[model samples]
Target: MFESIKNLFKKEEVFPCIIFDGKIMKYLDLTQKQIDKLQEENKDWTITKKEEC
Candidate 1:
């Protein structure tokens, strides 16, 4: 199960970081549109980060 979950995450675009609720979350390299959708879904949780190339 852990291997499957790791493989799933490996397939996704690597996110440098994410800032949510005044906290810094690393290792979540999601796209802007994806983050936007997440924010839309959960209005209370805000996410932002300095996009990396």
Candidate 2:
């Protein structure tokens, strides 16, 4: 019962990626903090989150 309830509240997984100069670089796993840091470091680049379903 608890397992099912926990599953209901589970968050979907996402993969982070960096797009720069028409190039896309995907990461296996990246936290929000890491993504923010990367964005800060590369102002010209773009950081995106892709849901893994």
Candidate 3:
């Protein structure tokens, strides 16, 4: 069962990082639209580092 789960996970693609300001945040998988939305909503907020989801 554990091996099957591991195999399922292995089939997925992962993104290494999301860089905001000068910081790097790791994320497994995130859509471009989601990221764009976050950036748009947080435009007025000060973010010095990236966020991972």
Candidate 4:
């Protein structure tokens, strides 16, 4: 019971990404698999991992 309660408060790790398709979109939290699929589908769009500063 306590373990489940603790787990509820825990935040999942996020891999932030940005996609440039003639516009600026920031703080896009996505998994590597999703990013790969997006890149594969959108060849013209530029996608990059966001660096934590």
lDDT of 1 by residue, 1-53 (tens): 89988887675454555656545454476776777788888787756565532
lDDT of each: 0.65, 0.65, 0.49, 0.80
Alpha carbon lDDT of residue 45, candidate 4? 84
lDDT of 2 at 48: 62
Clashes of each: 3, 0, 0, 0
**Which RMSD does model 2 reach against the true structure?**
6.6
Model 1, residue 16: distance off in Å is 2.3
Q: What CA root-mean-square deviation does each model show from the true structure?
A: 6.9, 6.6, 8.6, 4.5
Q: Which prediction has the highest lDDT against the true structure? A: 4
Model 2: weakest 10-residue lDDT segment is 13-22
Clashing residue pairs found in predicted model 1: 14-29, 15-28, 15-29
Q: Candidate 2 residues 3-31, lDDT tens each?
A: 99999998765555544534765554667
Better of 2 and 3 by lDDT: 2
Better of 3 and 4 by TM-score: 4
Model 2 Cα shift for residue 53 (angstroms):
12
Candidate 2 contains a number of clashing pairs equal to 0
Per-residue alpha-carbon lDDT of candidate 3 for residues 1-53, written as tens digits (9 for 90 to 100): 99988897664333444545435443434455555566688674322223433
TM-score for every candidate vs. truth?
A: 0.45, 0.47, 0.32, 0.60
